[model samples]
Target: MRRILIVGAGQAGLQLALGLQAQDYDVTVMSNRTADEIRGGRVMSTQCMFDQALQHERDTQINFWESQAPRVQGLGVSVAAPDGSRAIDWLGHLDHYAQSVDQRLKMAGWLETFAQRGGQLVVHGAAVSDLDFFARTYDLVLVAAGKGELVSMFARDAERSPYDAPQRALAVAYVHGLGPRPEHPDTEAVRCNLVPGVGELFVIPCLTTSGRCDTLFWEGVPGGPLDVFRDIKDPAEHLATTLELMEKFLPWEYARATKVELTDAGGTLAGRYAPTVRKPVGRLPGGGAVLGVADVVVANDPITGQGSNSASKCAAAYLAAILEHGDRPFDEAWMQATFDRYWETARHVTTWTNAMLAPPPEHVVNMLGAAGELQPVADRFANGFNNPADFEEWFYDPAKTEAYLASVTG
Candidate 1:
């Protein structure tokens, strides 16, 4: 069996290991956190798992719903502006899929499957020194670490994807007692607002076992009326300010919200940006090479909620490449080819999504206003990430944008 070491224990690392292990690769995963530490916390962000990716999980017997996950119909997405709203309901029947899992539960589940198959797990602090040693010892080393100190070793200065410009800042928080929309309390959906020049805010629902749902969220385009109170020391005042801003700048539909309960204020309010870079391939200072996958290579802005979908697609491609090389000396050409295919497939989705979030270049803004036709275009781009067939069609067609615009306007 080909021996491989995957660094980072998050979704990408776990998925990659699971895929490779099915082919009997001697896979070992190394990470700093333990199952207990990971599971004890609420997931930090809201994410979605598409039906296609879930199907892959079931095929690999990594399906979590059969064991610990909740299978639900798709989710709803609402786009709101300062004056009002536009909702694209996804509440009806659809193929089976899962929403965000407790990060800890997700970690625990993947780790269990990985170990059961006889793949080794190493829990330890990581450094360049450790990665360097592994590069020499293993036939293949996969770096799946997302943004953090650990990812710096493989980082490079690539250009900003045309669809996206320089990155913007965002603040994410989790809140409780955020009483649901009075009309539809049972729905699991995400509410988004293009708060004019202030960026966007995402309000998503996360269900807990106690029957109380937590509000998973994001505050984008910092430095506005909302930005003023972010560092405020008083919880009551901070929440009051948030509510006020919501009322003033968001649609009146959110005004019905009567209460806001806060929790885990002790947690962080970290920020992230776009226009990130990753090299085509990374080489260790001393000698060997490791393939950089997912966000480690290209970190897209989370505004579109495409991270997990992108990661899963990349994992699937990586698995195919490894399988084709079966038992041969690790083929460098095959690895690069696989990486290139993944990049080409992802480029448009990542670029267009980022472009929407970026302060629109002047020409783009004029074009959008001239047509009064940007929203539907933006919505289609966000929703299209999961359909591989559509993605393939999109990348091959240079005039897809013009075609889409003409169709929408017509």
Candidate 2:
């Protein structure tokens, strides 16, 4: 039996462990902290798993996704322009889709599944100084240390652009007491607004510990109206600043949900909200190979909510590669095939969404006004996000995007 050691028991690591164990590989997962520690601690991040990814979970493991559907079935999204003007209802594009549970719960559930299947979990305290020991011990070692820690591993090979500039830091709050669906609720779905020279504000529904739905949200683009709240030490002020910013940038929805309360709501979610962090796919100088996934490699402005979905898709592909090449060294060919497959798969959608959030191109603005024609294009684009293989087959193929563009435009 092949022995494998996976570092970082977060989403990708846990998912890989479960898949490999089912294939009957000798698998052990090591994380810097215990499962309870990771679950109870850590600043909460939002994760949205699409229908396809959920189905992947179901197809792979019988009970995997079945446990989380209450939170996954109905997903809603919308776009708000600077003046609080509405674009096409983003929910329409997502009505056919399903979402996943919070990141922490999702990871915990999967980790438990891995353990039940005869996999081992070791909580290795912060930092593993050497991989040579592990390389000798296990048939393969997978690293998925998220955001900040993963950056250094890819510093040398990445090309940086101004778009990489962290235009704004994000302040997210996971709040409760937001009452379960008011009779005439503001918007029936998640809300996103673009405040011209200011920043973007996004509020989406999430599940609370009470099992009632509340919102896991963020106020974006750090330099504008809420800049004063940037460095505050007070939790109340942090929540206050988010409220103030929401009122200014997203008045309609804010007005509708004024009475909703906030929990652990406040200050910058990350001290520095925005910084350009993109790295090339390759190995670390210390010898073990590492490929950046999700926010680590493709940290884009969260204005699109594509971060988690994108990460999950990349992870699924990565998992598939490991299962197929059993006992084979994860060599340069496998690495390139896997990493480049992710890049080729995700690059277009990532780029297109980034462009939408950036200073809008005139053509895009014009295209939005005639949304009747653009709606189907928007739906397909949103659906395509779930699986990149489908995307390449439909949009990125030599002449497909042009045809797709024409069909939407006409």
Task: Quote each prediction's TM-score.
Answer: 0.79, 0.81
Q: Candidate 1 on 294-339: residue-level lDDT in tens?
A: 8888777777666776777778878888888777765556667878
Prediction 1 global C-alpha lDDT: 0.61
Question: Which candidate leads the pack in TM-score?
Answer: 2
Off by over 4 Å in 2: 62-91, 126-128, 148-150, 160-164, 177-188, 227-229, 263-268, 271-295, 372-410
lDDT of 2 by residue, 40-81 (tens): 654456555566666656656733444433443233334566
State the lDDT at 124 in candidate 1: 85
State in Å the error of residue 69, model 2: 4.7
How close to the true structure is residue 89 of candidate 2, measured as C-alpha lDDT? 45
Off by over 4 Å in 1: 66-98, 155-157, 160-166, 176-187, 207-214, 226-244, 251-253, 260-269, 359-382, 388-410
TM-score of 1: 0.79
